[model samples]
Target: MTAETAPLLELRDVGKDYGSVIALDGISTTVRAGEVTCVLGDNGAGKSTLIKILAGVHRADRGQLLLDGRPADFGSPREALDAGIATVYQDLAMIPLMAIWRNFFLGAEPTRGRGPFRRFDAARAKDVTRRELAAMGIDIRDPDQPVGTLSGGERQSVAIARAVHFGARVLILDEPTSALGVKQAGVVLRYVAQARDRGVGVVLITHNPHHAHPVGDRFLVLNRGRSLGSFPKADVSRDELTRLMAGGAELDQLAHELERPAT
Candidate 1:
């Protein structure tokens, strides 16, 4: 929130191109610790491109990305993870039939014993999973419960908790609240607040202003692959944020046209 506090992740005039298409142009925003920076956009508004760039799925074609006030170049998502940037995608990368602990430590599993005897520390995994989820204010009857059995919001909480536990300094959430019911969305938003409270910078991408406005400390609006602008929550109202994401005058014109009868 303060200029004294450096951004955990920063984009300066970042751009991405696909063949002849410009997915993003001169987009810039900052994700600061203890803050949720929400990226709001409609379909095809460059949100996906921006997330890919942040997640290291695609490299930016222009400008710079800074991490911890130093220039950073990430070749792949694994590299990004090594740099403490973790992405919790919409699908959440969870296996439906797997137990919560297994899904929690899917790729990065704990091991014990000699090489040939090495095995996943199942006991530690389940215990850590249970403990971490509880720390996030999540109460699960069983760590062995299949992740699919949890509600949408609870699954999100698990993903978030895992990222935080694994030392992710920056959390990139793609459309976190999109498919959830109102109450469920609120539950996830609260955990988002919890992450920020624990000093993890968050880049929350979503199309819903109501979902974003409540937890976001900064709002970035994108339209047709270009940034409208990034505003501090203090500088932008929820209604205005919603209105701008609707494309403002363009939406008004479309509404007027819809009201007119066909000739």
Candidate 2:
């Protein structure tokens, strides 16, 4: 691949096992900068396992993880974070009672003073939070507002903007829109596109093909811990993706079996 289109993160035949159970097997995909790579799969499709591996919450039993064309093995979540890989899970890891700026810089808060005089730079944190959110096209009237006051979609967008602000090159979103309404989900997808426009490689994990197809440059479909196949947007239609995610031939057979006998 050319330097412009080279993968920021890549998985080569990656597999993971939990005792006798194989959670993932021979899964391969790539996440290029300024592009969204959607991982579409139904329940029990090993999506969680894959996320854990990518986020360093769990290690792969086999295969390779490449970061910026170099082999990488993240031993823990901190390691992955330090490597510029950030994950925004559904829960978002935010404190509802906390202010927006506080949540934005939770663990990595900015400090202004030194030695015994050291203290959190609340003003700088709030200012930077405001600017970052505005840069991402997220309009928050007040950075002092509690995170609990924002809508589900807004919460998701904040998480995305926070990742971008923290210099995350590879952002992994786990089921970002699964619990949202259609309009709300669209809001999250818009930010996903915005992040792509900003040259971030995004891994969007979702079960919805409709949500995945629109903004995704590539799609990786998984079923029962195995890949159905990986296809570029040019190679796969939304209908086909939906079918694959719904069990493809298995779904067709169920429809056939459920059909009436010439009634």
Instruction: Compute the lDDT of residue 36 as modeled in candidate 2.
Output: 91
TM-score between candidate 2 and the true structure? 0.96
For 53-116, candidate 2 gives per-residue lDDT tens digits of 9999999999999998899999999999999999999985578999999999998899987999
- Total clashing pairs for each candidate: 0, 0
Score every model by TM-score. Answer: 0.96, 0.96
Task: Please list the C-alpha lDDT of all candidates, in the order they appear.
Answer: 0.93, 0.93
Across 1-263, the per-residue lDDT of candidate 1 in tens digits comes to 36697788999999999999988999999999889999999999999899999999999999999999899999999999999999999985578899999999988999999879999999999999999999999978999989989888888889999999999999999998898999999999999999999999999999999999989999999999999999998999998988899999988898998896978
For each candidate, C-alpha RMSD in Å?
1.8, 1.4
Clashing pairs in 1: none
The lDDT, on a scale of 0 to 1, for candidate 1 is: 0.93
Rate residue 25 of model 1 by lDDT: 96
TM-score between model 1 and native: 0.96
After TM-score superposition, what is the CA distance of residue 103 in candidate 1 from its true location, in Å? Answer: 0.7
